[model samples]
Target: MAAARSATLSHLISTNEPPSLFEVAQLRRCVQTLVPRARLLWAEYKGLEERLQLCRIVLSPTRRLPAEILIEIFSWADKKTLLSISLVCRSWNASFNVVSSKSLSTTTMRFISEDGIPCHKILSWLAKPVTGTKTLNIEHEVSYREIRCKCFKPANPCPWAAPDFLNLLAKNPTPAQMVLRLKFSSPNCLSRLVGGAGNSLLWNSLETLHLQLTGNWSGRASIYRNALDGLPKTLRNLRLKINNPKDRRQPPPIEVPEAPFNTLKSLGIECSWDSPLILSILRLCVDLDVLIVDESIGRHTWTESAAQVTLPKVHTLRVKCLYLHESEKIFPLLHLPALASLTIDGGEVPFADRNWVLARSLRPLGLLSPMPRICLRTLVVQSINGLDGDALWDIFSHLRFLRCLVLQRVPFEGAGFLENYRRRTEGGEHLLPALRMFELRDLDEKFDATSFLCFVKVHRHATTRRHEGGHERIQEDAPDGLRHISLRYGDCKESRKFEAVREELVSMVGALERDFGVVVQMTRG
Candidate 1:
């Protein structure tokens, strides 16, 4: 009888008529008793499903694939997906690490402090030997918030707050190239590397060193001098960048070393202020092959003795001056007898600062005169404020060997600037007669596209003109003509009218490429 009663209670809800209050209470009690058990069973079922999926993955046929095939497959994935794949299993992570290590020779590790504590990842990564790293870049940044945090007490300061990488670096093989970018609130943070005797031996195998010092420079001149003195003399290429913010305090006197860097092959300097100390350093690099000078201000005056320092072997020279007056100081000073490539960048003037200075002129570049038969094959000029096309043509007239010309954001004073190119096809001696590569970007709004088309037609006929005049032209002397042409227009109000002639430009470029074997790339705004 009890068994029958239990069976009837189980089927209490099977009846069509609604249950009475007592029957409904009995049903509620039954459900409450089974709820916890149902939850436990569902969780167990989910665990089993996960284990089954894992078993399938472990027994997959793809696991037998060769490392080369796996590497090729991984190469097709983006960085984010590849990283996720690396985290899936230990074997996959090891394989991906091998592939990545063989592909990249340069590795950059950045250390950012939080509440006066060093990053644990960097510390652990340093604990192991970093094999196959040709160039190691270490950037240490200390934020003011971290230094001023409540947890940062001077008496009980963090031991790893300041960078001390000597012990860590000794574990790895000596790298050929090292780049140190340091930004700190106090100068004492550099004590480990700068104030130690192991400084010279630390970089014994270094051939290239790029040091960028940026931070509070209230009294940093001496520290900078010491840092330079401590560097290894075996460096062949050295680049120094001084990113000092504007300060109201009196500028500290900088004393540069009198010793020359006789082994240096290339030297580059970028600074915000004018300093005679830079000239002193340039005078020392007598065997420099390439020189780059980029300065932002023209306030300091250079003495006559320090003005004309000649670099006899320099074949490539790049000068970037933000102010118009800076050109007067830079051009007349450099005498490059073997100059092959010259780049003059007149930096852009912000819209807000345009009121202070109207435009920077390229007329100063003309000051580098009497250069020994300009072997200049490449000339790049961009973002000049007030450029005169006629005067610029006069500058190009001298570069008989100019083969590649790149001009960008150069606002000309008058229209028909390209008319000068026609003179080359009309007759005798002309400007840029050997130009084989021409690139123009962000052309002026008022520039006439019809004139440009005419120029291209003349350029196409340039070499034939040289053969015409019944004069026996040497086979080697014949110009290559314009073989590569690249034109890009920006999307702005000034370029809308230029877009109207896009169809005509495309047709002309296509004909040039098909008929003359010229490489042409043209993009409409």
Candidate 2:
């Protein structure tokens, strides 16, 4: 009977039909008798898990960053980046402040002045320790608007800008390259700046200084003199302007005082060479190896005393002569025994024009018998209108030691000379026998491309091949013909599919490389 009763209870528990009132009462009694502590423990465990999750939310990665570091991150963001950050959330927008450098050497800092901010403040930012800047260029000619800004209350915005700049150099870590370009400034600032130059820290570290002084030069020699005197001996390269005195009545300074810059290796004078100031500076540069003289418009001719300079150590000479006939006269004055490279650019009027003949350009070297030919191995002539075949030969024939020749901006009219030269290549007369590299730039399509191939064919690899003859042996020892020919021209030389001449030129260039191990490069402008 008891087993039957237990079976009936099991059936009732398993069945899905509605339980009777008696059965419900029985279930309730069973639940009331269950273990109370077990239920209590499960509820406690769930509560703890929820609290642990809340702790994790509080310790998120972003919350770990320190306050100062976060500010720095915001500071580094540029205006655009900051705006984007601001759009992301109100918090970031509120924190956005200013952005602020690390061997700033070789890196250029471009500072555009604004109305409210002073230039001194801008310079201070440049001198910041983290900048490590080795090159600094301050230019006032940014834009027309900046010049006309209204924040500058004084009649002169920065009349003292030049002097203040000098002061900044003294205080900041001296940079390797410093260029100051100002406009319409008084000479008095130069005087005041140099007066305090002894205190400038730049004297010890500055290697190259380029100063362009734009103003009237009346009787301001004392200011210029004082400034030039402050230049330290450590300066190796200098580019300065020493304009001729406005008063022609004032003769050249009776005694030229030599600046104490014996270590200078290069000097570029943008002043009138006629100024005694320039000549005296040259005398001080005993070790100057490279000299570039850029003449001002006032005067082209130099007095006899100013012209004569014996720069024996100078191996490279580059002069911009405005006058056509002045170069020849200038050469007698420069007894450059060690001159190995020469670059001459004829202003406006191409040197290849009728008046400026190749022979006339060289008249200065004194190409007579006992007077040895200029031992220039490298020569560069640019902006030549036209050089006839004979003129080109005259220039090349004298340069026995010629190794590299660069002709730039040479018009197509002159380029035909190369064809004439090849047709009349005299027997055993090797023009440019030692030539190793030839570069012709800025040529149009009219240029004789065929002459270039012929020149290479005759000259290439001829240097190493020994010919059994008296003076011919020397030519063999001379370096082989042109090793490199770089041609840079415009649209005319562009390769076309059906152009036979262009295709032939391409084939010729390829053959030279394959057969003679030469490098022929063609670049389109």
Off by over 4 Å in 2: 1-118, 124-135, 138-167, 176-188, 220-227, 245-257, 273-277, 296-308, 324-329, 350-361, 366-373, 412-419, 422-424, 461-470, 473-477, 491-502
Instruction: Return the TM-score for each candidate structure.
Output: 0.64, 0.65
> Model 1 has how many clashing residue pairs?
0
Give a tens-digit lDDT track for model 2, residues 1-525. 446546757988798788679767766665675557668888899999999988997787766666466667876666677677667544444454322232232333334434322456547545554433345544323345543222122243443344555566577655434533322233334444455555677645667766555434444344344445555555677777655444454433433345545677887876653545555566667788998866444443545555566777998878665554445444566677788887867655534453454455566765322345467778888666656666677667767677898888755333455555555554546566677898988766667777776667766644434232334443445665678888776646446622544566887888888988888887666
Q: List the residue pairs that clash in candidate 2.
A: none
TM-score of 2: 0.65
How far off is residue 30 in model 2, in Å? Answer: 56
Query: Clashes in model 1: which pairs?
Result: none
Candidate 2, overall lDDT? 0.59
Expressed as tens digits, the lDDT of each residue in 415-488 for candidate 1 is 35556555533656555667788888786445555566556656666654655763434347646577887777
